[model samples]
Target: MRQYWVAPVGPFHTADGTAYATSITLTDVSPAPQITLPANMLEIGSEIELEASGFFSNTATPTLLLGFYLGGVAGVALAASTAVTTTTAAVAWPFQLRYRGVVRSIGAAGSIVGQGRLYLPTSLVASTTRFIPETAALRTVAIDTTVAKTVTVGAQWGTSSASNTLTCQDLSVRLVT
Candidate 1:
C-alpha cells in the first residue's frame, strides 16, 4: 500500500540526496499553484507546523480532542477540551521532532483559541501531552520507513451533540529542519 502524505513547498535537500527523493510538479491555478510530494516521504529531525480552522456552534457543552500524531500514534497533544461551547475553534501548532536510534528529542507548542456568542455560559479549555510508548519493549527501538511516522492534525467531537458543526477548513503540515 502507498502511504500518501503532504509536504512543504521548496527546493529541499537532505544530507544525502539519495535518502531524500521527491517527485515535485507544478500546475497553473488561480493565485497560487499546487505541489505534491511522493507517498510516505518524511525525515527525522524535521520541524513541522500544522494549522486547522473550523466553526463549532452548539446549544450545550461538548468534548473536543485536538492533537498531532507521529508514527501512526498520537505523539503530541496540541489541544484537548473536555467542555467547550459554541464557537469558532482554531489550532496552530509548531514542533521539532527527531529520533536517533533509541533516543528522541522534541520541542513543540500550540494553542486552541475560540470565539463564540457573548453573554452565554460557555467555556473552552485545552491541554497537551507528549508522545510516549505504552509498551516497555517499544521504547528501545528505531523508527524505520515501515514505522516512519508522519505529522497529522486531528479534532474529534467526543459526544453526539445537537446543532454542532466542526468544519475543518484547513489542515496543513510543513517540514523545517
Candidate 2:
C-alpha cells in the first residue's frame, strides 16, 4: 500500500522559500471542501502559514469556517451566517502544536482521511470571525510566528464537495516540523 493523496494544486514554497504551504483547488463542481489543523502542538520558534481554495463551478459565493484554539480559533463548519467567495483565502491563528509525528501521516493514511495537530493543549475551543469578501491565490496566510504555537487552517467554497487541498512543499516534505 503506497501512501499517496490527490490534490488539484501543489505543496509549494513560501515567500522566503523557507516555510511551505498548500491549497485545495476550487472549481465550480465537486464536494464542499473542508480542512483543519487543530492547535497547540507546534515546535517552539516555528514559522508557518496555511492556505485553502475551493473550485467553484459557478461564482455564487464562498463561505469561511474556522475552528481551533488560542486566540481566533472557531468551529470547522463555520456558521451559515459567515460565507465568502474568492480565488484564494487565508486565516491566521496564533498557536503551538504538540503532536508532530501524528499530523504528518496524511499521505500515508490515504485520501478522505482527515489529519490534524494540537495547537491549544489545555482548554479553550476557538476565537473570532474575520472573513474576507474576496481572496486571491498567491498570498494567503500571514503569521508572525511569535504569538501562536500551532493552528488549524481550512476553507470551503459555496460550490464544491471536494476542493483540492495541498500544503507548502516544506510542510508536505515534513507534515510536522
Candidate 3:
C-alpha cells in the first residue's frame, strides 16, 4: 500500500513509505463499569461502584440513579446512604447512597433500576460545557467506582423518589452483576 486515507478523518503514509487504510474508527473509547448489585436483598448498609473499559463513562450526579424494584413496587436505594455525588471527567467518584427512608420490596423478582446522564463533570471538564447530548435518546452515563463508591438515590430526588421516572439507553440493568 502506498498510503491510507481515512476520509477527512485520517490520511497518512507509513514510515516505510507505504501505508494501509484503517479497518475501522472508534469513538467514545471510555471504560464501561460492570455492576454487581443483587436483587431483593435487604439494605446491608454496604455499597460499591465499579468501573472498567467499555463501561460507565461521563456519568452525572442526580442523573445516574440505582434502585431495587419488586413487581410494580420499587424501593429507592443509596450506595450506602448517599443520594448524590459529583462525577469528574474520564476519572471516577466514590460515595455512599442512603436508603434510610425508602421502601422495601413487597413483590418478587426485583430488579435494580439505574439512570444515565449526559452532563459533564465539573471537576474534570471545568470549562463550562454545553452538556448537549450526542443523541436525543438515552446516554451511557453512570457513577464510576473510583470516585463514588457508595451513595443513595432514593432521598436525593425527594420523599416520593419511587415515583421518579427511571430512564436510560444502552444500559444493562439487572439484579445480578
Worst 10 residues of 2 by lDDT: 104-113
Winner on lDDT (2 vs 3): 2
Tell me each candidate's RMSD, in Å, in order.
Answer: 14.9, 16.6, 19.8
The reply for model 1, stretches above 4 Å from the true place, is 1-40, 70-151
lDDT of residue 42 for candidate 3: 27
Q: Kindly list the per-residue Cα lDDT of model 1 for residues 1-177, writing each as its tens digit.
A: 745344554322221101101111111111111122223343444334443333344434444443333432234332222232333332221212222121133222211221111111133444233332223344333333333344333344544544433333333445444
Better of 1 and 3 by TM-score: 1
lDDT of 3 by residue, 80-167 (tens): 1123343423243221211111222212322222222223234533422222122323122222222212111221222222222221
Q: Which number leads on lDDT?
A: 1
Q: How does model 2 score by TM-score? A: 0.22
Q: What's the best-to-worst order under lDDT?
A: 1, 2, 3
Candidate number achieving the greatest TM-score relative to the actual structure:
1
CA error at residue 89 for candidate 2, angstroms = 19
Better of 1 and 2 by lDDT: 1
lDDT of 1: 0.31
